[model samples]
Target: MRERLFAAAERVLAREGAAGLTNRAVTEEAGLAKGLLYSHFADLDDFVAQLVLDRFEAIAAEVAGLPERAGSGEVRENLTGAALALLGTNGPAVAAAALSRSAVAERVRQAWEGGAPGPGAVEEAMARYVEAEQRLGRMAAEVDGAMLALAITGTVHHLRMHGSALPDDNPELVRRLVAALVTVP
Candidate 1:
């Protein structure tokens, strides 16, 4: 039920933008009762915050495995894969929705700051992977792993939060950026 509502919210955000987001719209889109959302979440703000945080958690969990793949794949593909993971399904719209409401945004910010998984977790996971690859002689010794992680995550964050297209929509674009950021060993 929660996932269904979240997906409905994503569609609303993507098609109607921030201005049109409302509990009623989300419920209607989900084909659930108007008050069904309230029954699940404390309020609209809680729903929005959970949606954004849940998405971030999903991406972070995926990137958490980056270190394990360090020695097996091409560094660019590994790193670019992590970057793309950060931009999960409907990322841009989800980000826009989070930013559209002050209460929701603050709730997410506080939850992230409180150490729940979020954007920083993705960056940290990538950095760990870079360092692991560096130690394995899979990457150049001169490259700063943390900066590389930042570059990839920052660029991905931009695309996730500001881009109109999904990362999957133009993976080559992300690959290009990742290529530029990662050095050949």
Candidate 2:
């Protein structure tokens, strides 16, 4: 039921943008009783917050596996794959919904404050992966894993914010950035 609601919300968000999202719209899109939303969430803000959080959590989970892939592939390729997986999702729409609504933004802020992982989790995952590679002598010993993680995630966030307005060449750019960061002396 939660997946149904989330999918419905995603559809509404994708087709109508944040401004067009409403409990009624989500319910209708989900083809469920309106009361189901209220039963599952405290309000539209909560729903929106959960929607975005769910996506981030999935990304985080995927990233959490990066350390295991450390020496299995090219560092640049692996990092690029992770970055692209994040950007290829409905992240832009979820981000827009959270940012456009103050209540939603507050909910998200509260979640983050309450120990829910945000972009920081992704950065940390990337840092762990980089550290693993450095241990294997694949990355520069002098490189700061955390800093490189921040740069990659920051660029991903920037690209996601611009959405379709930006050209579709960001994957290559991210690849190059990762390559530069992992380059050994």
Candidate 3:
């Protein structure tokens, strides 16, 4: 039942945006009794909150699963591929929905603290990247890996929000961004 609710929420979020979701929409989409939503969730707010948490968990898993390319020659390729994969999910609606609720924000925060990998996942990836770069003599020894990771993640997130309608799963821009970031100038 929770799975059904989440599936409905995911579809509605992707297709209609946060502003368009309602308990009725979820129930209808799930093809469940209208009361099922209320039973599982205290209210529409609860449903949306859980949905946001679920998304964060999903995104974190995706990031954490990226193959660790430590000690590889294509550091940029690996990092960018991971970053793009994490950011390019259909997320505008999820972001909008999260913006509407403190519960969602709190849940996201907790997940981040737990190293779930949605937001902080990028930072962890960067740390790995910076370590790789240092090992390869690409970045300066004293460079802040976490800060660079945040910057790259922010840039990628913004690009995902505003860039051209490229395929979400394609890693071309990710590869390019990674190349630009780690290349010794």
Candidate 4:
């Protein structure tokens, strides 16, 4: 039921904009009793906060494939693949939630500023790729993978925020940006 509620929230957010979000609407959409929401969450603010966190966990899961690459050209493919996936799904939601929910805004700030755990998905992916590149002597020893990760993630998030004019469901820009940012030099 709790999962249903969050799923409903995501559907509403994707379809009707964050301003249209409401507990009653979510419960109606979820086909669950109204009390289910209050039973699972203290209030809308708590639900929104959990939703924000859930989105990050979703992105992390989507990109979890990056770390398992073990063949030629795998590193670049993994990084770019993860970046594209990240932008395609959770990217827009994160941006929308930031504008619609203050808790999301605060969490995004903390995560972006390195206050969150483990330097985030982009950072973790970048670090893996950089280590691989360094092993192959494709990158300089001084390259800061964490900084590049932050930049790439920030760019993707910002682009998604203002990306209404772009081709719907196209992640070409995100792929290009991640490629450029993580390129060996």
Candidate 5:
């Protein structure tokens, strides 16, 4: 049910943008009763907050599996894949949500305070993958894993914020960025 609501929210966000993301719009998009949202969430802010967190959690799970790829794949390839995944299904929607006023932002802050992983989890996942590569001698000893992770995620975030206005070239751009950062040999 939550997944259904989240998908509905995504549709509404994509079609209506953040300003149009009312509970009515989400319920209409989901084909569910309007009351269903309040029953599951305290308000629209809570719903939006949960939607953003759910997306981040999904990305975090993907990142959490990066260590298993440590020695099996090229480090650059692995990192590029991870960077691409950061832009997941909800990237544009999440970026739109970020522009909303206090309600949604406050709920997100509260969720973070209550231990939701949030954006930092993506960076940490990339850092862990880099550390794994370093341990396997796939990355240079002098490379800063955390800094590299930040650069990748930060660039992805910037591109995501630009959203459909730009061509779909971010994946290749990220791939090249990762290749530049790692030593394949």
Candidate 6:
């Protein structure tokens, strides 16, 4: 039920942007009673924050497997895959929703700061993956895994936050960034 609400919210966000996202809109989109949303969430702000954090948690979970992928596929491909996976979700819309409401934004920030799964979690997984790749002699020995992780994840965050910069080519930009950082050899 919660997942349905989240999905409905995403669709609402996609079609109407954050301005059109209301408890009624979400509930109607989900084909459920309008009161159902209030029953599950405190309000629209709570719902929006949870939706954003849910996306972050999902991406973190997906990227968490990066280290396990080390020593397998091309290093560039692996890194690019991890980077693109972050963008593959409806990150920009979710971010826009959070940014549209200050309270929602603050709640999401506090949750992230509290060590709830967020960008930092993805960064850590990336660092571990890079370290694993380095161990396998796929990445440069002198490269700083943590720093590389920061670079990639930071760019991803920026792109998601300001999605209009490269509207049609975020994945390409991520791929290029990963390529510039790590050599295939």
Pick by TM-score: 1 or 2, better one: 1
Residue-wise lDDT of candidate 3 within 1-185, one digit each (tens)? Answer: 88788888778877887776888888899998878899987877777767666665666566664435565656666677667656646555666777667776676667667755466665675677677677667667776777768777877766644544765534666666666666552
Q: Which candidate, 2 or 6, would have the higher lDDT against the true structure?
A: 6
**For every model shown, what is its TM-score relative to the native structure?**
0.94, 0.90, 0.75, 0.78, 0.90, 0.95
Candidate 1, overall lDDT?
0.87
Tens-digit per-residue lDDT, 71-157, candidate 1? 897889988888878877688888888988999999999999999899899889988898898899988788898888888888878
- How does model 5 fare in lDDT? 0.80
TM-score comparison, 3 vs 6, better candidate:
6
Of 3 and 6, which scores higher on lDDT?
6
lDDT (10s digit) by residue, model 2, range 43-115 = 8888889988887778887777998898887778888888876765667877888899998889888887887
Q: Which residue window of length 10 is worst by lDDT in model 1?
A: 164-173
Q: lDDT scores for all predictions?
A: 0.87, 0.83, 0.69, 0.67, 0.80, 0.87
Show model 6 residue runs off by greater than 4 Å: none
Model 5: number of clashes?
0
Model 6 lDDT tens row, 136-158: 88887888999999999889888
Q: After superposition, how far is residue 154 of candidate 6 from its true place, in Å?
A: 0.7
Clashing pairs in 1: none
Q: How displaced is residue 98 in candidate 5, in Å? A: 3.4
Candidates 4 and 6 compared by lDDT, better number: 6
**Candidate 4 to truth, TM:** 0.78
lDDT of 3 at 65: 41
Query: Model 5, residue 112: what's the lDDT?
Result: 73
After aligning candidate 3 to the native by TM-score, how far in Å is the CA of 33 from where it should be?
1.6
* TM-score of candidate 5 to 2 decimals: 0.90
In model 6, pairs of residues that clash are none
Q: Can you list the residue pairs that collide in candidate 3?
A: none
